[model samples]
Target: MTSHVFRVGNGHDSHRLADGGPLVLGGISVPHNRHSVGHSDADVLLHAITDAILGAAAEGDIGEWFPDTAEVNRGRCSSEMLLEVWTTIQQHGYSIVNLDCTVFAQRPKLGSHKLKIRQHIAELLKIEITQIGLKAKTGEHVGPIGHEEAIAAHCAVLLQRTDSLV
Candidate 1:
């Protein structure tokens, strides 16, 4: 069987630190004292992944689709945003083949928590956990992230066209 596959998109997202703000990461509310600074929930990882998918499919960027000023998105769940992205991809007759993403932060050792993040993303996209790749990195005390006052993420995605249902 021949399937069409030849597209790429990169997504990058970052957020400032909010002291005593709710720390929500990868759709999971992490136990951290500092939260992300943004109008929405400020999920750096999900934001990056969403952009990657939308970019790969040539749909559009996250901001255009989900404006921060929109009342529908005020303090909304990032997972819901991601699900909407999935819908957009499906609408374009695209399917996520695989995705690789990395999260950058200074505090909170991520080695042990990578699996949880991976599982949650897999469930959200309704794909196998193995298809989702999650990596965590520390800024090594070098930049704003190193100072533990910010977080960022990078996502690369591959999308392929499946047979049209119609």
Candidate 2:
């Protein structure tokens, strides 16, 4: 009988909004009045996805791998970060099965960009676009996100071991 092992991980990330920047999310540029603040490009969606992939492989998160204080990490593109982390995940003998992600924001509605975001992620992960699920939510004017002060993203990933123990 064939046996398979599956692992699941959840990751979340948030960044404060700031002026004079271009909003980058899911590796795609989104037109907005403000952008997320961070040492990297601050693509919250990609950050969450990277975290989920690392977590699934029992590896540390983005901060540990790419600290804000590191000069090499500053202003780096998040998609590149995700690719590097994905290499680690692949080396651990695991492959992503699927990923579901949600973005929390209060401005510049993301509804229209969902497909583009999903396609970008699918290309990054080398998976079918159908394997990526994207969702957007508003903060309902309750907190930092609600007040348009920040943007957040959450991602859940399922991974399976590709090698057989036999």
Candidate 3:
């Protein structure tokens, strides 16, 4: 029997930097230049990951599920939001096969944190670390990200139907 092969989905997220605490990406808070200001803790990596899984399953974006309008979501951590998205995808009979993500920043040197980020995401998605591809890029001194005033991420996911695992 042919496994139900469907599609690959892409997700992108961005947030501005704020001066207060260190920044958190991919669930691990890195001591960086500035933090992200948002209604939530604003872990941009997790936000992108959540979007990828949701998109792969043809579900709506994060805002559709966790609206900024809801007072409860205010000051919420992005990891928690991501967990909810993963649950929803699984319930809909979809499991992520692999995901490739890119993080754009201008400072703090992401080289030291890539491994931790991979481990964090793998743990969150219950997937092998090999299934995740993470890349970091500098904005080349251009745009908001180049000024170290913002960070953004893009994620693409390949999800397989749960029934096909057999």
Q: Please give the lDDT score at residue 94 for candidate 2.
A: 79
lDDT of each: 0.86, 0.90, 0.87
Cα lDDT tens digits for candidate 1, 71-116: 9889888899999889868776777778999999987777777888
Q: For residues 71-121, could you state the per-residue lDDT of candidate 2 as single tens digits?
A: 999999999999999987887787788999999998878989999999998
Pairs of colliding residues, candidate 3:
none
Ordering by lDDT: 2, 3, 1
RMSD of 1: 2.9
- Over 4 Å off, model 3: 1-3
Winner on lDDT (1 vs 2): 2
User: Model 3 Cα displacement at 152 (Å)?
Assistant: 0.6
Candidate 2 TM-score versus the reference? 0.94
Order candidates by TM-score, high to low. 3, 2, 1
Best-matching candidate per lDDT: 2
Q: Show how many residue pairs clash in every candidate, following the order shown.
A: 0, 0, 0
Q: Deviation in angstroms for 14 in model 2?
A: 0.3
Error of 1 at 75 (Å): 0.6
Q: What is the C-alpha RMSD of each candidate to the true structure, in Å?
A: 2.9, 2.8, 2.1
How far in Å is the alpha carbon of 129 misplaced in model 1?
Answer: 0.4
TM-score against truth, every candidate: 0.92, 0.94, 0.94
Candidate 1: clashing pairs of residues: none
